[model samples]
Target: MSHRIVSKFGYYSLAGFAGSALVQLAVIWPQTWIAVVALGAIALLYFAFLLICIKGVLKGARWAGVLNFNVLGVDAIESTGIVLFFVVGGVWTCLQIL
Candidate 1:
């Protein structure tokens, strides 16, 4: 689990967000100018976590581990919300048919 907890998923999460921020900006061009700040903030958070882990400047290695898990925790929360929405929507449609 250390591979996932410490290295694999956390690093990928940061990189993925950074990539998405760029894509998000491109997709939201013109009228939605403010999305740059919003998505940039999310992307920066991931990069900051990556920097702290790589730099070894934190008080302890444990804090990096904690932050890594926190990243996963956030991912799970967002995924759960989306999943719950779909589940609720599906049930609502089913109920209407019944």
Candidate 2:
């Protein structure tokens, strides 16, 4: 196993976080201050994880790999849940509006 793979994931996570923030801030435009603040906090947390991943990978630490997989698992679950909501529940999906 190579740390390169973890670094790659970190990069992808960074992109994803940036894209998600763009969508929330620009495209969706959250309706309330609370929502905006919450989103910002989440974005910060994601970036923190990315930094931790980079540090761990660079140091060849086992904890970094573990953290990476744990974060990946959580993301997979959230994505799968959203997709299932649309596909299985016949939900009408729409972007958030300000």
Evaluated with lDDT, which candidate comes out highest? 2
Q: Which candidate is the best by TM-score?
A: 2
Q: Report the lDDT tens digits of candidate 2 across residue range 1-98.
A: 79986785565555455444544454445464465456556655656666677678778797776663543466755543333332222111113333
TM-score of each: 0.31, 0.38
Candidate 2 clashes between residue pairs 3 or more apart in a chain or in different chains: none
Pairs in clash, predicted candidate 1: none
| Model 1 C-alpha lDDT per residue in residues 53-91, reported as the tens digit of each score | 555535456556555344336765554344344334433
Candidates' RMSD to native: 14.4, 12.1
Deviation from native of the Cα of residue 81 in model 1, angstroms: 23
- The lDDT of model 1 is 0.49
